[model samples]
Target: MILYIKYMVSLRCKMMVEQELKNIGLHYVVVELGSVEILEDITLEQREALKRNLLKSGLELLDDKRSILIEKIKNVIVEMIHYQDELPKTNYSDYIAEKLGYDYTYISNIFSEVKGINIQQFIIHHKIEKVKELLLYGDLNLTEISYKLHYSSVAHLSNQFKKVTGLTPTFYKKLRRKRDDNLENI
Candidate 1:
């Protein structure tokens, strides 16, 4: 039996879900970001118990089709940004549409209506977050970050980063370093 879960975006959320499943005496064959496949059919009682347990952790056992599709879209984007080393070579709209098996326009409209953000804006938000992570870790230069994130140029990445955060990537990195240094003195 396959179950869709909402708000299961992070690795911690996955672990919480796995623990909840074990506590409920269910064994899962697969436990990915947004969905789980149980080894055996679950009972109504088990479902209710699982739902209640997941709710306590701010996760929902999804049933609505539109909600499930929305979660799937979010899961796809999250997995691409955080888990994958590289993004799809194709344009994001094509990649998302192909993965979801839906028209890009339809998906975009639905996501905007539900989340109040366009898909492009959503992708930019996540990409900027990834940039911050790389900067914090001091692993990649601006040019490399631009290339890894598929930006047109370092200037473009800088402009977008500044616009989103009101701080240049370089300044952000320095600020984080300063804060870490101050903490070390304590």
Candidate 2:
């Protein structure tokens, strides 16, 4: 049996889900970012119990098809932006469509409807967050960070960073503060 989960966004989240499955006496064949596959079938009662337990830990058991698709989209974006070391050369729309095996138009429309923001905005938000992280680490200059993030130029990166964050990249980096949003909330 396969189970989709919402808000299972981090390695710690994966561990928590695995622990919960064990606590519930369920044998899972695999547990990934936002879903799990169990060895045996689960009854509705077991599903409900699992849902409650997961809720206690700030996770959600997804049952609806649309919601499951949304979660899959979130997982793909999160993995691409935060977990992967490098961004792909291709456009994000094409990458997401190919990865999810869905039409780009369909995915875009659904994402906008459900998320109240377009996928482009989501990508930009994540990119800015990534910039903040790199800045905080203090390991790279603006030019280096722009190159690493595939930005066209340092000027462009600085402009966008200031537009979204209301501060120049240099000033923002100097603050040495963390400003990030929850993946689930994104």
Candidate 3:
């Protein structure tokens, strides 16, 4: 049986889901970001127990088609931005549509209706968040970060960063370092 889960965003959420499945003695074949497949079909009691357990940790099993589709879209973007080292050479809309096996226009319309924002907006948001994380790590300079994140140039990255964060990446990095220094002193 395949079960779709909502709000399974991070590694911690995946771990919690895995632990819950183990606790219930289910032999899961796979547990990816937003879905799981088990070797055995689950009983209603097992399903309810799993749902209840997951709810306690701010996750829910998605049964509705629309919700499941939405989660799949999110999972694809999340996997691309957070997990993959390099983005696709093609346009994101084309990549996403091809990957999901759906028409881009239909996907965009449904996503906008469900999410109250366009898919591009979601991608930009995730990209910005990833940029923030990379900046915090301080392993790469601005130009490298821009290239890694698929930004056209350092200036474009800086403009988007400033537009979203109200501060440049350099300032944001310095602010984080100062805050960490203060915490260490405390």
Candidate 4:
């Protein structure tokens, strides 16, 4: 059986869910962001206990269809922007609509209604975050970062980065370098 989880977005959350399953004496084949696959069927007692345990960690076991769909949307964006090595070449709306098998308009409306921000804005937020991470790592230049994230150009990436963070990517890199150097001196 496959179970959906709410607020299980990060690697740490996946670990926590795995531990909870072990504690509950349930064996899961896989634990991933927003969902888990169990090898054996679960009992009501196990499900209730797992729900309560997950709640203690600020996570939730989802039950409703709308909630499940919302989590799926978030998971897709998170996986695409953060985990994938390269952003998809296709437009995000097309990618998302294809992935979820729902009309773009339908899910976009639901996501905006529940998340209070449109999905495109959410994608931009995550892409900017990825750019920051790459800048700090010192592995990719602005142009390369922009290409990896599928921005039109380095200038476009810098503009969006500045608008979201109030700091140019160059400035952000400098600040991180200074901070790291200061830590090393102490």
Candidate 5:
């Protein structure tokens, strides 16, 4: 049996789902970001109990096919943007379509309809967030960050960063450092 879960994006979420499965005496084959496979089929009663337990921990079990597909799309992008060590070599639309085994047009339409933003916009948002994280870490320079994130150039990165955040990358880094220093002083 396979179960799709919403809001199961982080490692912590995977752990919580695994623990819940154990508590319910269910043996799971694998627990990925947004879905799990169980060794044995589950019962209706078990499903309801599991749903309630997951809800208590801010997760929801997805039953609708459309909702499941949406979650899968989100999980794939989140994993790529936030967790992967290197960006994909191919373009994002092709990557997403190939990964999800659907037509790019269909996926884009569904994602836009459900998320109220185009898939490309969603990817840009996640990429910017990742850039913010790397900048705050202070280990990577703007050039290195751009290269790693597959940007064409540092100028491009700076432009997108400014466009999305209304502040340049250097300014954002300085602001984060200032906030950290203030917290340490207190």
Candidate 6:
């Protein structure tokens, strides 16, 4: 059985999910960002138990199909922007459509309807959040940060950063304070 989870974003989340499965004597074949596959079918009682346990730990077992699909979209974007070292050369819309096995129009429409924001805005929000993270790490220069985030140039990155943050990247970095939207909220 494949179970879609909410807020399974980090490595720690993966570990917690694995532990929960083990504690409940469920054998999982795989656990990857927002979803898991188990070796055996789960009973309703077991499913409820899992859901309750997850909720207690600030996680959720997604039941609604639309919510599941939305999480899948979020997972794909999160992996691309925050985890992956490189993005595809093709446009993000094409890449996302291909990766999700859905038409770009459908995905975009559904995402917008459910999230109350367009896909492009969501991507920009994530990209800016990533820039904040990279800046906080204090390892990459602005030029390198722009390249890593697939921005056209440092000027473009700075402009977007300022637009979203109301401060230049340099000033934001210098302040060493966090100012960005939460991933789950976005």
- TM-score of every candidate relative to the true structure: 0.95, 0.90, 0.96, 0.94, 0.96, 0.92
RMSD of candidates 1 onward, in order: 1.2, 5.6, 1.0, 1.4, 1.0, 5.5
Per-residue lDDT of candidate 3, residues 1-186 (tens digit): 889999998889989999999999898888999999999999898899999999999999988998998998999999999989888888999999998899999888999999999999999889989999999975899999999888999999999999888999899999999999999998
Off by over 4 Å in 1: none
Looking at candidate 4, what is the lDDT of residue 114?
91
Query: What is residue 134's positional error in candidate 2, in angstroms?
Result: 1.1
* Each model's lDDT: 0.94, 0.89, 0.93, 0.93, 0.94, 0.91
For model 3, the run of ten residues with the poorest summed lDDT? 133-142
For model 5, what is the alpha-carbon lDDT of residue 110? 93
Model 3 regions lying over 4 Å from their true place: none
Candidate 4 clashes between residue pairs 3 or more apart in a chain or in different chains: none
Q: Give a tens-digit lDDT track for model 4, residues 37-100.
A: 9999999999999999999999999999889999999999999998887778889999999999
| Candidates 1 and 5 compared by lDDT, better number | 5
**What clash pairs does model 6 have?**
none
Across 1-186, the per-residue lDDT of candidate 1 in tens digits comes to 889999999999999999999998999999999999999999999999999999999999998989999999998998888789998899999999999999999999999999999989989999999999988885789999999999999999999999999999999999999999999999
Global fold similarity of model 5 (TM-score): 0.96
Candidate 2 total steric clashes: 0
Better of 4 and 6 by TM-score: 4
